[model samples]
Target: MDIPSGDTARKRISESTIHRLSRYFRTLSLLEKENFETVSSKELAKREKLTPAQVRKDLSFFGSFGTRGLGYPVAELKAKVSRILGIDRIWRVALVGVGNIGSAMVSYKEFIKQGFHIVKLFDNDQRKIGSNHKGIIVSDIKNLRTELQDDRIEMVIVAVPATVAQYIVDDIVKAEVKAILNFAPINLKVPSGVHVRNENMVMELEYLSFAMVNHHSPKGGGKA
Candidate 1:
């Protein structure tokens, strides 16, 4: 099947470009909310620690998001970026493993503020499976397929332990979920067309600690 122009652009664009686009969108949204009318590529780049040429090139992937002289209109660019990122669509997400992190996410205002809604929470623990948290009742893992079918869940958040990460992911795939945000420290393999994003919190913390140590090193040579 032929991919749509938007999808093609997304596929062709580098991952770094997509990340920069997300940053630009967030910055532009803040500027728009502050009632800023126009912003130059240079200013935006300076704010985001990116090059003007890179910013322009990234925006160009979507067919000239900015004017030649006026840069990019804040509101228009915000809307365009939102559309490009598919933020306009409300994605129904099913969260597996209603433990500490998962339960916190269920009550997190940011998820609700954004379009991603956790419609179902699943856990194998009998005590938790029937409990309610933040208005999202916990359901048994066995009902994953049925709930996914009934709710048309498009995304899955796997917050299970590393030991059961693969098994839970397999169940999620069996339920036909296409996208997953995995919090476990395991590398999960999925079939083609399935997207998996790993959230390695320990790695992130280690990186942060490494950066801090290097930043405050006496000789400024603790590079890695």
Candidate 2:
């Protein structure tokens, strides 16, 4: 594959762009399921509430995907997007906590079905460490490094307590993991080049409540 120029590479693709690409792929999959053959960028953008120019630019980053007159083929575009995002390959994931949220995630069938396989689960609690969840045994946190290396886990899910978030991240960095999805409600300081995605449930719920309260307020005129 021809690499993009430095200028193109330096043109940082925002998180929103990546997310939209995934969304586009999902939409295309649905269209394919409905027997739709091709889709114009303008049509896709309208359905997704995005600008056609934005759609074109995002897809252009990969390569010329559409002809001047015709639009992108649904199946081809879906395959290209999946390949670009590295979703075509299975990604090994390791979970660092076996608490309620972590256990639920471990038992969630969606992750495994979506190409992210949880090869190892870890926890500090002795009783829980040796137990099994969804056919995967919870291992001791002390063995994180060894298990990570053995399982070739590239991505990690940090569900440890907030107090130990930083400590766990540090250990994860030392384990040479590339990407992390953090559920702990703490700002973690990771070394450069490592990706950390924080999923803060409390913050999301608070934001939702704020939106609801403001929407119903007299000052806001109950817009709905």
Candidate 3:
């Protein structure tokens, strides 16, 4: 089931709507395991603590997933959502830096289960280089560009220090790898067409702290 690459639908999809689809996918997976054949919008909404209308609207943007009375087929909907999210097939990934956060990401079981396979590791420290973590050997940062290009990496997760992050990113860009998940605290400068997702733990924690003090809950099913 390949999703269309239509410009109109792609432009209309908000980050919020895509996020809810992920939630809906997870809910559908649980329903399948529970022996559910079909699920109504109202039922899915209740489980995810969202309004039925929002659920319907989100799913409608992609296409009809439910029948008039029978509702959406659980297993089928899950498969569709996975394809839409581009997690239906394996993505070869590389991780730069063997620090605490980087190591944790490699050990995360969900990454592999969800089709993100981190097959390369890079670090500047000579001691860390050549070391193996969970069967993937760490390569020297000097060989970062060549190794990434040779391995045909599709995405790179950066967990390096703030000072040298840009230098590392420059090499990645030169290699023509466009997707980056950066854990460095500083913002990275990348040219247009490059996708960079920053993972700032402190900023997220601050948001949670503010929410707690203000007695505020995230609206539009945006809670983490």
Candidate 4:
């Protein structure tokens, strides 16, 4: 297959392929920790429970990184995948609503490990406003847009109730914050240029329930 290079490949990348890239990065990290110098497509596919062709196809979307006998350099490939996923640099983020899920997101160590720093926090509750967690003082939701702009937040996590999610997102849009991770059950209406991803735990659980009841095997069952 012709391995396309340059920015053109980015425009044609699929969300599933991006997700697989994350999985590849994770496996590569594990392999590096295990002192594996290089990994072949078959080995990567075996670890990820995928086919070698699938693995090669995913990497081919970006560019050729593997050699016939040498395979792929673990650390170098991991770094390349990180850059591809745009997680190589730190992203300034703000979390709106200091409720249950919001607080959990703040405590997640993986966020910082993945270069997503929550430098600012916001909540409408007077009790939470001005409270400190992990060295960040929670700002009042009233000042969300202004604070977000001032702090130069690249992304936001909205954990407020569904009723107010749209309202909060409207201001985030105004602040020119392009990316959002929403926990509210309701789907948010965003402008064409804005990007929003929903984290609905209940929906995921529903999918699990469906799969269990249906004995659903995922589409690809082949391993390497």
Candidate 5:
């Protein structure tokens, strides 16, 4: 099967579709581990809390899978989704800031397994410089530009405080890192052609609280 081509075709495939593909990939992996050879869309959808039609529509964007009467081969579907998501090749990642979130990201083992390799850790704190965490040496943030140029780092993770997150992101942009995952609570401004995904746990928690309140509200989850 072929990946969706052309900017127009790519644009038609929504980010939510891509996210669901990852979930499907994970489900296929678990099914594989359980010795399942094939999976029907209905069965897979049940497992993922999605409707069968929704699962089928998402898979249609990539290509047809599963036989008319049979179903998808677990291993084959996983490989296809992985390739479609561009995770087939390993990605070099650089992380700036060694605060709690940053340190935990460095120690996360799943990233490497998923093909994201954190090659260097950078922090401005003097005490943290040269310190080792999770087999990665922490270097001073001043060396970021040089380190990025010397290495093939394509993605940067910024986990510093909100006050300094934009400055760190500017450095990352200057270094030509195309993608960034920022955990800082504030939004960052970047130039065109660069992508930034903000991961704010506080925002998520607040949203969760809103949902919980809505669920118990008088109108059966009506808007507040």
Candidate 6:
């Protein structure tokens, strides 16, 4: 992957671009597991349901990884994308709210495999404060700032209710966390330097339902 020189003026890449890169990485990893060595842009695009031009354009931003005709080595491309996404190194993550969603995240193996470790769990509830799951002792939310600073946790996942999500995020920011992945179904305002990504499962499911309904509409396959 091409690393831009200090003298090169770089423009901010879009989130969609990064999402596509992640897809490419995942697809490449699968292919690598199947013992594939190299793949062409056309083949990669076909696997991703993208145009060859689109795949090429997305990769071009990071520098050329593919040969003129032979294509990209699967292992090399996967590592490059992982590096670009900042997942090549282990990142200590703090989880706020050990409820259903938060607990699920705690047991999620993908995050750990992808180099994100949930080192701390927090909640304001007294009942949950001392609870333990997979060796993670739930701590009081009041200790978040000190624990984050002490542990040097740079990222946090906010799986709290919408009402208190922003408050938790504020505490995360005060602890100098750099990134957040929020599962609460609400918008949050954060400092300029902090990045927050909201994941709304309900919104996604609603959109999927709309698409399914449209697919079965009268003009398509549904009964009049």
Compared with the true structure, model 2 gives a TM-score of 0.88
lDDT of 5 by residue, 1-224 (tens): 33466653443677778788888988888999999989999999998777899889999877897787888988898898899989999999989999989988998989998999999899999999999988889988998987987887899999899999888888888888899999998878999999998888888678778878877453423321
lDDT of 4 by residue, 1-224 (tens): 34456844344677778889999998998999999999999999999988899899999877898888889999999999999899989999999988999999999999988899999999998888889998889999999899999999999999999999999999999999999999999989999999999998898788788888989886764211
lDDT of 4 at 125: 89
Tell me the whole-model lDDT of each prediction, alpha carbons only. 0.84, 0.86, 0.90, 0.91, 0.87, 0.88
Q: Pick the candidate with the highest TM-score.
A: 4
Better of 1 and 2 by lDDT: 2
Off by over 4 Å in 3: 1-9, 215-222
Error of 3 at 70 (Å): 1.7
Query: Per-residue lDDT tens digits of candidate 3, residues 1-224?
Result: 34457664244688889888888888888999999999998899899888889988898877898898788899999999998888889999999999999999999998998889999999988999989899999999999999999999999999998999999999999999999999999989999989999999899889889988988867754464
Error of 5 at 14 (Å): 1.4
Clashes of each: 0, 0, 0, 0, 0, 0
Could you give candidate 1's per-residue lDDT for residues 94-131 as a string of tens digits?
Answer: 89998888888888887766688888999999999789
Q: What are the models' TM-scores? A: 0.89, 0.88, 0.92, 0.93, 0.90, 0.91
Q: Every model's Cα RMSD, please?
A: 3.8, 4.2, 3.0, 3.1, 3.9, 4.6
What is candidate 1's CA lDDT for residue 27?
A: 90
Q: Could you tell me which 10 consecutive residues in candidate 1 have the lowest summed lDDT? A: 215-224
Q: Any runs in candidate 6 off by more than 4 Å, and if so which?
A: 1-7, 213-224
Candidate 5, residue 32: lDDT = 93
Better of 4 and 6 by lDDT: 4
Model 2 CA deviation exceeding 4 Å by range: 1-10, 216-224
Candidate 4: where is the Cα deviation over 4 Å? 1-11, 221-224
